[model samples]
Target chain A: MNAPSANTLGANAISAYSISAAVPLETAAQLEETLRHIGATRYHSLHPFHKLLHGGKLNKGQVQAWALNRYYYQSTIPIKDAVVISRFRDRATRVEWRHRIEDHDGDTGAEGGIERWLKLTEGLGLDSAYVESTEGILPATRFAVEAYVHFVRDRTPLEAIASSLTELFAPNLHEERISGMLKHYNFVNPDIMSYFSRRLTQAPRDAGFALDYVKQHASTPAERRAVCNALIFKTNVLWVQLDALYHAYVDGHVPPGAFVPAK
Target chain B: MNAPSANTLGANAISAYSISAAVPLETAAQLEETLRHIGATRYHSLHPFHKLLHGGKLNKGQVQAWALNRYYYQSTIPIKDAVVISRFRDRATRVEWRHRIEDHDGDTGAEGGIERWLKLTEGLGLDSAYVESTEGILPATRFAVEAYVHFVRDRTPLEAIASSLTELFAPNLHEERISGMLKHYNFVNPDIMSYFSRRLTQAPRDAGFALDYVKQHASTPAERRAVCNALIFKTNVLWVQLDALYHAYVDGHVPPGAFVPAK
Candidate 1:
């Protein structure tokens, strides 16, 4: 077998390193620190598009593309949560998780995160039916969101939970997004931005439980590595969507048949 | 329900039209014509990346990105086929479909299509391990591929079979790819291009059976439209992968962590 190259050392390197060397276990605090470090360096908040978005550099059309594409990701969350819930055999564990479904889907007559997201799309002048159809969203948006669902369905339960740890960084990004969009764009308002406002609270609560679960359950060093890698994977899942958005909308090379902002 | 708009007519307009009107049934020959129309218009061979790659306009590195990104799609064929197989209750249908799995993943010692694809990547100088890890492929590649597997797993069996109808156009593209790449690039060799050579025969035999299956089984107009739409969906799956390639490689905006063509 070939030696693990020096470049193959972090998240993507797990498979290579797992075969050759023992990953040293971290304490709970250390694991938390490591996860935080991943958030610091790898999170989508640091992505260039987010910088452009929050800095008021993008025009309204660009912002519309972001909202339209992101709706695809926002809408898939409950489905991902449900897949995670299905994987758990214990009723109590599922009961604890069922709140996530409620949080996204909402009770009868109550507005949910998805409906709130649609309002944001509508605020940007996207037709509600078009946004709901997801017909015009970028291919990368569909792929990234769908990957999240499949990951939860297919990964070990621990890794699935660990992937959710990206939520640990979510509240801060939501804060940035809400304040930035409201301040910069004429179209933004409190009602449409409610999704971010709601997520600011919901994400932290969800992330806390997930972080605690992952830290406690991923006891072995290899399992810990997998947990870290899963976060990194989740980060990529978020990051790549933005990358596609930046390439298509920002760089102006939108693929044929994808959403094109009306000039 | 709203009436179907004059604009909402073909494969893409199904969801709109389905709610509004009774789709007129077509004779077998007419149904075949519609499927062929979808192939002619929507197939990925029409993608710019294919034109560049086949025309020898792309450098070796750009070619490498295409091959590596495409490896994800090629490798998943067996898994998608297996999902389709699992959906079938009849032993005869499953038996007929099992050849797809076998074609992708050959018997012991006889290299399958996937392995042959790796030889193409390796010929372009990518490490076999990195290629297999799929760590470096485009996110769109993964999403498009996983969507395909999920579609086969979750959609009705007839729709699942119809999605495979993109193969109806595959043999001709494979022929073009082989001759064009051979004529242009010194890096292209018979051994590396063997995957296409093999598929020239295999895809036709497979597409023939699938066409017959879909043509015979989709007895109603709605079902036939669904079959046509499924082909269109599959074509989009293929087309979008190339679109991602073009956006990233040709347009010179390789997403932050995707495969970078070596200078």
Candidate 2:
């Protein structure tokens, strides 16, 4: 059923299975299973660009585009988390969410996820100023990241928390990325890979809380469907960034005024 | 200087000229010149995809892709305009801005921009329900349009008004598209191209007010720069939609689950 038949409606087909009928509300384990099924099929790890990236098939310029464009996404995580926090009325829930902002932005003078992301870009020869300014990334990158912030700001709190569940699938991808890049690319090393390493722990803790919150809060069939749709939306955000990178860098059709890796 | 040089940073170079030096503010005419210069160089009309589209170089499927993806952008205009209206405190200003929402959404039974846009899509043999659902659009299209909404929601009212000044460059593109698409493609006709025909009038009226608003309100040098940058941001929003279309359809690398034309 996942194979997109001629009669199926493309990307909409993935959701069609759940949306076609009003099934009975699932138990906690069943809901988790449904969420996991979404991750298994639709995560960005399944994207071709990730294949090229982790397999070391991408050249240095392509890799630079990946890091440079991805910096925008990494930097915006704290902003989106903050927006998510603002939506919560409960102090305990807000306190639980505040850790996400801390993880990305850090306490005074501490290196946060954003700075670690810069280390990866700097390792690949992009200027910290330029990366921090986010002036060189693909337009798709900006749009995708900004959309995530808006989604959290505008969607219901239940949906916002569910969106963060993409992190449940993230750790495995990070592990593969770290080992694959370290094994394959001469330029990639432990320091430059620190962002992924840190995420291996942070993502699981974050995803665990988010998953629990969603499982507990999504009390009805419709609420459960919205939760699933939010995860799908977040995955689209990640997948589109890679699609833009692959289009511009690997395919070598850089839009006028976008970043072009030096020969 | 417009050509991306080997030493120059890619798309970021366009903004470099502005960031490098802070110049004195100008007369109304000079400010208009600067705004038009940004449009001349960065408008989506300048994208190669537009050249392909207006030149009738793209096939029917390609045109369908263009229409389908752009429906997401067109449909969201009222929502973004509503967000813009929410930001204004002045009663007179809100009244003036309210026309934008009406132009898109229309009065009872009056065919507005969104409905007219559907005529274009339906004329191309796409189901109205499928088009309205927007379930098959490129992820980039969603991200780009959503970013524009967020920009309006998040930025100051002055900047939001300036962003709408992109309409200044719209009428001519509409004229070109109407004539070119009509002359070149048999599927295109005055009935189907009513959206463009309508916009030719609507754009100028809207752009005139927005342009005057931006020029009058952006009093300081920094404020003027922000206005110019806002227009540039809006231009990027439009350009990126075309870029996504080109990358996905023209480049033959549609992301998994996006619309794929039947053979």
Candidate 3:
């Protein structure tokens, strides 16, 4: 097998994720390194759209477009996590993962991550109802995000957990976003951005459990490879959403019937 | 209820197709008019991408991107039709729909519509295996096409038949495509473009059966409205695929992991 080329993660390469090269049985440290390498190279943090977003190069309207489309992703996370939990028959695993649903969709009185996401979009001048409706997001956003849900629902249980491994890299991006958006955009404040601040802790704890589960359970090299592939697929899911935002809002080609930010 | 607005079919509207207004009981003729009006406004034939494609304004690479992405939709039709078939308990409907699958998948030793689609892609210089693998098609293509399948699977049987109503408008686009490509691109020949020619007849027959089924079966005003909404939904399905093509190819913002036509 050929060595994983830098081009393996290019936007236009392939649908299903595969390893860059043949798998060989490896130590836990080695497998972890491979997973981290995939993140370093393939994560959505590297996307130009994020750079534009965090760097504050975008206008209020552009930011609105981003938040509006992103709400769809944010809203769907619990559904995806629920699907992941459903894939496992183990009660402990289900109980361990069950809190993720609560993480996004809080208990009776407390607001959850989805509510926090609304604060961000609402702060950006998007209507809360419209954001909740997901009526105005890009078709690509809907497609890519739904694709993630389907991936989790359809793939093996190990792969579903591995797919959430994007969370492993999330704390860093969340860190960058909170500081960068606050520093850069006048519209951004700590309250609207509380989602990230909270995730700084929640993500690492979640990622830690997931990472350990993956490392322990991927018993064979082939399973190890599947774990890595799932991570790469998750990154693609995250990456493509940004690509859609960049294409529609940044490039000024707002597709017909999507949200049109006021001039 | 508000009359159907000009923007009801806009590209970025709410997803699940709903009527512009509540259904008032209507004659069969009124319902048919509503469905026809939807096609005139919302069909992919009206998309700028198609105008460019048929007018030969796109370069060969652009055409290749179109064909490559569209192959995903073409390949999914049989699967979608089968889902439609599965939804039906009526043997007459099943027998009627069974031939649609045969037309696409073909009997032993007979080349099907999918094979003809590969010929077009092959004529455009795309590898047959690559085209068949669908690894390079856009995420939007997969999402939109699969959304159609799910729509069929999840909705009532009448809506499933109504979703195929886009075929009512397909023959005209096929004729325009055949003549336009033959006249404008030397690389396109009658042999390579056989898929459109075949669809010219097949689509009308399929559409007629579907249209009659919808009209005859939709007994109530709400049912009639659903029939119209189903056509609108189908049109949106077609419209978004072209919109994805336009964003990726025409606007030059190809998303990661999709087909990038040769330079």
Candidate 4:
């Protein structure tokens, strides 16, 4: 198959159904390489929306639309993690995974990633209540985010854990975003950007753990392929969110009931 | 709220959160009126995609995209109905509901709705395996269709049954579609259109049962409101699928991985 462009929006580019592993990799190291390859090629960082976003070509309203729609994805991570945790019977695995939930939802009085994400939207002049409500976000955003949650809830424990492997690619994107938005968008500040900053450290730890788990556990070739497929599915989940944002905000074909940015 | 146009694409038009029942209706007649009102404004029959489809403004490729993507929705109904049946413990309710599944899934040798739908896709020249695989349908279609399945699985049984009330409006749409497509597109024929033709009778029976169940069970104002909200949510599920189709196929912004119609 011809190599897909970085900017191609269809998940078909890295479809889970595609039998990419006709000759599956034989070692954990090879499996790890395959996972990284999927990340490099299919991750949302390659989406054109990210290019427009990080390059600061978008107006405040456009950026606001991005943040608002994305808030659905951000808020859903803990719930997805909870579903992931539920998939495991092993107490140790559950213990390890439950912290991911805490990292997002937080302990009493401690700010979690979701609360911090709201600060970004809040900094962008969006009302936190409305941001939390998720009422005005794009329908596509709701679908994609729910798709992620359901993926974790429905897939096998290994596949669920592998889906989290997208976090392996998150740190670099987060770094690019923190620096890019602060550099380009005047409305963005370090405090509002704290979500990505905190994620820089949090993501690597999470990704490392998930990566090791997938490699150690995916013993058979078909199992390894399922792990790879899960990562590809997760990337599609991320890529489609940006695609929807680009179609609605960038192309200016926002559906009737989605958030309409201020004039 | 301003009166939403007959063709508004957003579910926010009939938002379940909108507190439409400021003074809850005093009788089932009033509640039924409110539901019919929601259908009049918010049902997917009002979507411009449907208008384009039924009015014969779309090309053969566009109609094919509609049929192919719609097959996902068509194929999912039995699974959704099965989930609905799972929600009930009563023998009468389960027995009543199981027929809905049979009507779609069929008995051993009997033909079912989904097979009829496959005929429509096959008639349009889509590969039966490809359509059944659902590999080429829009991401938005998967999300919307799965959203309906999850809605039935997750929501209260009353809310679940209420979601099916969209069928109350389906008979008219099926009539319009069968006549419209056969008249406008030479690619469409009466044999391929069997699914909608059959639904003309089946939908009314299903709708009558569901509507009566909702009216009898939703004795409280709050329950009645929940019932209305479920219908609105279902309409959104249906409406977004078309919005995605319109954006991808008609507007020529098909995402990288979705079905690309033959030139």
Among all candidates shown, the one with the greatest DockQ: 2
User: How many pairs of residues in model 1 come into backbone collision?
Assistant: 0
Alpha-carbon RMSD to native, per candidate: 4.4, 4.0, 3.2, 3.9
TM-score of each: 0.88, 0.90, 0.91, 0.90
Q: Cα lDDT of all candidates, in order?
A: 0.81, 0.83, 0.82, 0.82
Best of the two (1, 2) by DockQ: 2
**Which stretches of model 1 miss by more than 4 angstroms?**
A1-23, B1-25, B252-258
Interface RMSD (Å), every candidate: 4.9, 3.3, 3.4, 2.7
In model 4, the clashing pairs are A10-B256, A10-B257
Model 4 misplaced stretches (Cα beyond 4 Å): A1-13, A16-23, B1-13, B16-23
Q: Put down candidate 1 lDDT per residue, B166-230, tens digits, no spaces.
A: 88898889999999999999999999999999998898888899999988999887888778778
Candidate 1 clashing pairs? none
- Locate the minimum summed-lDDT window of 10 residues in model 1 chain A: A13-22
- What lDDT score is found at residue A160 in candidate 4? 92
* TM-score (C-alpha) between model 1 and the true structure: 0.88
lDDT tens digits, residue span A13-108, model 1: 333112224334456665676677667767899988999998888998999999998988888999999999899998977988899888878889
| Per-residue lDDT over B1-263 for candidate 3, one digit per residue giving the tens place of the 0 to 100 score | 65543244443322334555533437776677767767876678888888998998999999998999889998898999899999978999999999999899888999899989999999999999988878777766777787788789878899889999988999998999999999999889999999999999899999999888888999988888878777776776777688778877888767655677777
lDDT of 4: 0.82
After superposition, the stretches of candidate 3 with alpha carbons farther than 4 Å from their true spots are A1-16, A21-30, B1-17, B22-25
Cα lDDT of model 4 by residue, A146-259, tens digit? 988998888889999999898998999999999999999999999999999999999999999999998999898788888888887788777767777887788776765678
